[model samples]
Target: MPFERVRLERVRLEPWKRRPELAALALLLGLLMMLHSHIPNIAGVGSLVESLLPWFGVYVPVLLAGALWRRSPSAVVALVLPVTVWLSLFGGLLTDKSHPGGDLTVVSHNVGAGNSDPSGTARQLALSGADLVALEELTDQARGTYEKGLAKAYPYHEVRGTVGLWSRLPLSDTRPVDVVQGDVGPLARTKPPESAAEAAAEVRALRTTVATEHGPLAVYVAHLGSVRVMPSQGFWTDSRDFGARALTKAVAAEPNQRMLLLGDLNGTTDDRAFHGLTSRLTSAQETAGNGFGFTWPAAFPIARIDQILVRGVRARSSWVLPETGSDHLPVGARVSW
Candidate 1:
């Protein structure tokens, strides 16, 4: 009887010993992920991993609960660090409630370059009742279609590089923004354009001032270069990193007090790469959105790359519009002075 009791005690303590190590590992991973923003050029791999980090917060608590139930006090304590960090980063999301209050309506859409149905996409965007519409990935072929389709509703419009802004109000001072492209090393300069037309197509970043009823709102529409993952390289986001930095500098230099940036940032607001932009602006969705507001791959959006950010204006309500023909869904926000 004594031997059996001792064996049972050992079995019970075995799980406790393992729990500490597991808990420690989880804590370490969580910390690394949290600090991922500090590591440069992680766009390819880091960005992808970071996109999923918010989900880990869900499992960490459950694991800690299990540890506590098993009477592992040390393990429970180990969990505290990660739990605190995660909550600090994402806790605000818990209290977000949709409240309607603004006067101006704005929309942002990526309208994938490869979209097969530009007309359908244009029609859907026009119906959103937006006072201002900003579009990215505006390839030459689709520009005319968009201009013609949207002209009926938005009489004032401007296109710079591959991005465009259409407004119910007049738009002026439109120009291309010079976002840094990664070091193609000497190769890019020397590599002749595939054709003269391809060389002209190179122009693709733009900014414009929308003359809203309230005043002139500086609007920036940009598409950061895409990030790619590779086995040997780990991650490749240098182009996006450079572009984001340049854009940040430009926004900082702008003379206007009120600013609105709408586009497919190629990153989430949570991404550190966007710290420059996020630090200066406020996300409309977090203030008045009802849900996560994911707006990519229209089939099922797990992440939000399309966004509407504002400064000097209050967000009344924000939401994603129904899918058009593009891969991304449209995002709309109501704002006021």
Candidate 2:
């Protein structure tokens, strides 16, 4: 009886303590994924990894489920490593936080170049009661529609090439910024030009001073050149990177302390290429929003290319409005000094 009891105690087994190697491998992969930004951009692969960096967090859930199914104590324990790392990186963004009130209300939208109803989009934005509105991808034919629609609400506005800014307050010293320096228009601009005029034609960025009740706020409205992933060329970001660098320089050279940058940057802040802009500006959504606040492809939004970033001010709240006629939804933010 004593020998049988001792053998039973020594041979006791559980399903949960079966596999440890699987869990360790999963955590190790997760750790590498967490440090994706530190990875090199060999043949532009690093930048590509950075672009999809945030999505890597999804792997944690998969690993979690596997760990539970295998019921391995070591594997479950290893999962803590990736879980902690993911939370440390993106934990702040997952929470819904906000301040009480704000002084200024601003909105930004891409409004889709092929949008069938530009006037309707403008009307929808005007109804939002925003003090300032910024629109990108403004086509030549649809520009008039937006201007006429928003004229009564936003009397002071400026348009340069495909981007425009409309404000209820007075706007002054408006100038086109050459985010993409070339003669070819943005629609035709895929690569750098050989003998194009400096900061001429196809301007995708504009800067102006807005006289608000709080003070003068320097506003920059931009539609940075779009990027793509081609089968032959790989991850295409040459134009967007060029534009981001130029815009960063322009913003740094700015004399004003308070600034607001509204645009469809065509890339997320997670991407390393946007360091120039993200370093200088703070995202309103990350500061005060309920969820991910994705604003592209209104039908089934994925990423937040359209953004409202502020500096020298505090954002009390930020939210993405309901879907409009355009492909992208409108994004709004409330800010105060």
Candidate 3:
């Protein structure tokens, strides 16, 4: 009966019924990644999924390993679905797209308010060799330090609210764009700052135009409302999402065609919340960086919340700068007119 036993083992290994559960899971993962936007945002599930979507490809290999262990031919073949979907979505990010030089080099950083050494951070930024540097979360105590520290490198600078732009070039039409979506959501109960300066210090977005040899390049520096996970509320993103929508309106009214948006947007281009902004601007990191340029929780970054997006400008190269004292790393990009 050795021949019969061999036939049974072969049949079990080759049949679609073997490891059917694994096959189904493979299909599910493929569809989930492909149609993540339609997953619905109840409890911020959709945002969470899309924010970490690129990492979902990790499951494909796990499933493949399981299939191999089980010796299920059907399961191994089914893994192809998720693999293809994953490569289609994130394969482009695997290669280096950065070019050698460009007309402008801009760097954006959140510069955590809780950063212990603002002066050190400023010094690092000044020596970073950027034509323009945009900073967010400028506390009252650190503002002067940054202005002084970045002065030698960047002769011209402008600060509107907590957002500021320090540039080697001239700046004009400087103003703050309010991104507060009323007093609702997670920040509804947040206490107001002590004085007018403090209140202004609390503001998180600004718009300014830079005088370039080619033309006027409008630059926006923003730090959208923060997000968090709550046991009771699931993935809490009300504040961040509201801020994104408000920022979208301001961008929609922008007059300049050549524009550069730099900041810790508090969300990635992968997240659907930035759809309006992404539709208008191209992410420098996504277009030119070698890999996923994650810039958050500086110690070990997993998501790319900081961004340098441009319109009517070619992003020749993109990269992440060395760690500063802040919680988020700096993102730099070279753009040409």
Candidate 4:
């Protein structure tokens, strides 16, 4: 009887001693999150991985379940590595950071060009109570609708190419920004003698100075090139990364001290491609928002591709607005000089 009992105890202990592969995988996940920046951008896959990096946390529960089912003590102990790493990376975002009032409220929305109801989207934006609004992906037919719909609340507005800015205050020094990767600024930004349709095709970014009571606030509106993923091409970020590099140069050369960039940057702040932008400007959502504040795919947001970055102002609060006809959701930020 004693020998049989000893054999049964050993059989039960076998599982705790096995499944080293599970423990190894847990450690690998930790390393991936901890040293994600070190991963090369080979074929832009790194950017894609980093873009959805937050979702990596989902694996924690998955692995935990496996560990429990397998009765592997090593795997259970290994889970602490990934859990700690994930919390360290995004733990701050799990908390609320918003404060009360602000000097100005700004909203950025990439109203999809395929939108069926531009007028309705415009009406919703007008009701957002934003002092300034930046819009992207505006089609020629819908441009007039937005202009007319927002005329009452926003007296000053500028439309250059597909991007536009509407402000309750006065606007000046407004011009298109040539965000073509290697294109020279002076030549690229110039609206040459071309048809309105040609201008719309060529321009996707703009900058303007809003005359506020406190002082002049330089605002930049941009819709960087889109990204795509394919089985053959993997993460195709060539155009978007090109635009990012060019936009970084433009932001570096900006003379205004109080500057803000509002747009659909096509990637997250964690993306290495936007290191230049993130290094200089701070994201309002990350600074003062309630949560991850994902603003893409209005039906079910999963990532925060849209951004409101400030250089010389304080972001008091940030939030995502109610969905409109557009595919992308509108993001708002409250700021003070």
Q: If scored against the real structure, what TM-score would every candidate get?
A: 0.84, 0.88, 0.93, 0.91
Could you give the candidate ranking by TM-score, starting with the highest?
Answer: 3, 4, 2, 1
lDDT of each: 0.78, 0.84, 0.90, 0.90
Candidate 2: regions farther than 4 A off: 1-21, 182-201
Instruction: Kindly report which residue pairs in candidate 1 clash with one another.
Output: 162-204
Candidate 4 Cα misplacement greater than 4 A, ranges = 1-15, 181-196
Mind sharing the TM-score for model 2? 0.88
Q: Worst ten-residue run, lDDT, model 2?
A: 192-201
Better of 2 and 4 by lDDT: 4
For model 3 the TM-score comes to 0.93
Q: What 10-residue stretch in candidate 1 is worst by lDDT? A: 180-189
Candidate 1 overall lDDT versus native? 0.78
Q: Tell me the spans in candidate 1 whose CA falls farther than 4 Å from its real position.
A: 1-18, 38-49, 61-73, 180-200
lDDT of 4 at 148: 98
Q: Write the per-residue lDDT of candidate 4 for residues 93-209, one digit (tens) a residue.
A: 999999998999999999999999999999999999999999999888899999999999999999998899999999999988987535432233454636867755678899899
lDDT of 2: 0.84
lDDT of 1 by residue, 1-337 (tens): 6999999988777665446765776678568656867655432666766655666677676767777676676777777777887877767666656676677899989898898999989998999999888888888889999999899999999877678889999888888787744434222345656885765465556778887778888988887776656566666666667778888888889899898888887777877678898898888887778767888779988788888888887888889999887898999998888
